[model samples]
Target: MTELDPVIHTPARLRIMTALNEALEDGDEIAFPALQKLLDMTAGNLTSHLAKLEDAGYIVVAKTFAGRKPVTRVAMTPAGRGAFRAYRTALLDILGGSR
Candidate 1:
């Protein structure tokens, strides 16, 4: 059996990775507010999840000012993208072999 990535396995974390994956593919960054809206997560929830990913070196968090307002943007790192792809492959392998 292929081992799944524990970091990306949780439902909420999975959703987080998925959102970041899509944005990464589009060569775009997701703002904290935007990610919260996309995932239907609260600000605190989003912040915690993002912190986990950031700690794992899977994503980069940048805080800058948009005019006078602070803006937080998150982007998946190359390592994060690779990990996600590997996780997907593991899932597919399990499903395929199960059938």
Candidate 2:
């Protein structure tokens, strides 16, 4: 069995990563509030998960302002995409054993 990445194995984080991977083009980003809405997560909860991903160097978070309104965006790094693909392959292999 392939080793699993603990950083992205959590349920919420997995969902966040998967959503980001699927919904946006590589190197593109989603607004924090948009991600929260898409994932149906509360601000604090989403922030917590994002912080973990950022610490792992799996994702990038940018904070700025748009017309004086604060804006936060998140995007996956290339390393993150690679990790996610590996994770998915491992999961498939593990599950494949059941067939």
Candidate 3:
């Protein structure tokens, strides 16, 4: 049996990673506000989970200015993509064994 990634196993974190994995498949970063709207998560809650994913080196958060307004963008790192793939494989393995 393969072990699931603890960092991404949490429901919120999983949702975050899943969203990033799908959204960023085009190789584009997602703005913080857009991500929040997509996930339907409050700012504080999203921030908390983002912190964990960032700490794990699974995502990169870039804060910059768009003209006069500050903008935050998030992207999944290469490591994050790999981790997410592994996590999915582990989940599939678990489910496959049940049948």
Compared with the true structure, the alpha-carbon lDDT of candidate 3 equals 0.94
lDDT per residue (tens digit) for residues 10-97 in model 3:
9999999999999897357999999999999999999999999999999999999989999999999999999998899899898885
Give the TM-scores of the predictions, in the order they appear. Answer: 0.90, 0.94, 0.93
Name the runs in model 3 displaced over 4 angstroms.
Answer: 97-99
In model 3, pairs of residues that clash are: none
Candidate 1: tens digits of C-alpha lDDT, residues 1-99: 799988889888899998889766644688888889989999998888888888989889999998999999999988999999899889989889432
Range of the 10 consecutive residues with the lowest summed lDDT in candidate 3: 90-99
Residue 83 in candidate 3, Cα distance off native in Å: 0.1
Strongest candidate by TM-score: 2
lDDT leaderboard ranking = 3, 2, 1
**Which one wins by TM-score: 1 or 2?**
2
Per-model lDDT: 0.87, 0.92, 0.94
Looking at model 1, residue 6 earns an lDDT score of: 87
**Model 1, stretches more than 4 Å misplaced?**
97-99
- Give me the candidate number with maximum lDDT: 3
lDDT by residue (tens digit), candidate 2, 1-99 = 577789999999999999999988888999998999999999999999999999998899999999999999999999999999888888888788431
Candidate 1 Cα RMSD after full superposition onto the native fold (Å) = 2.2
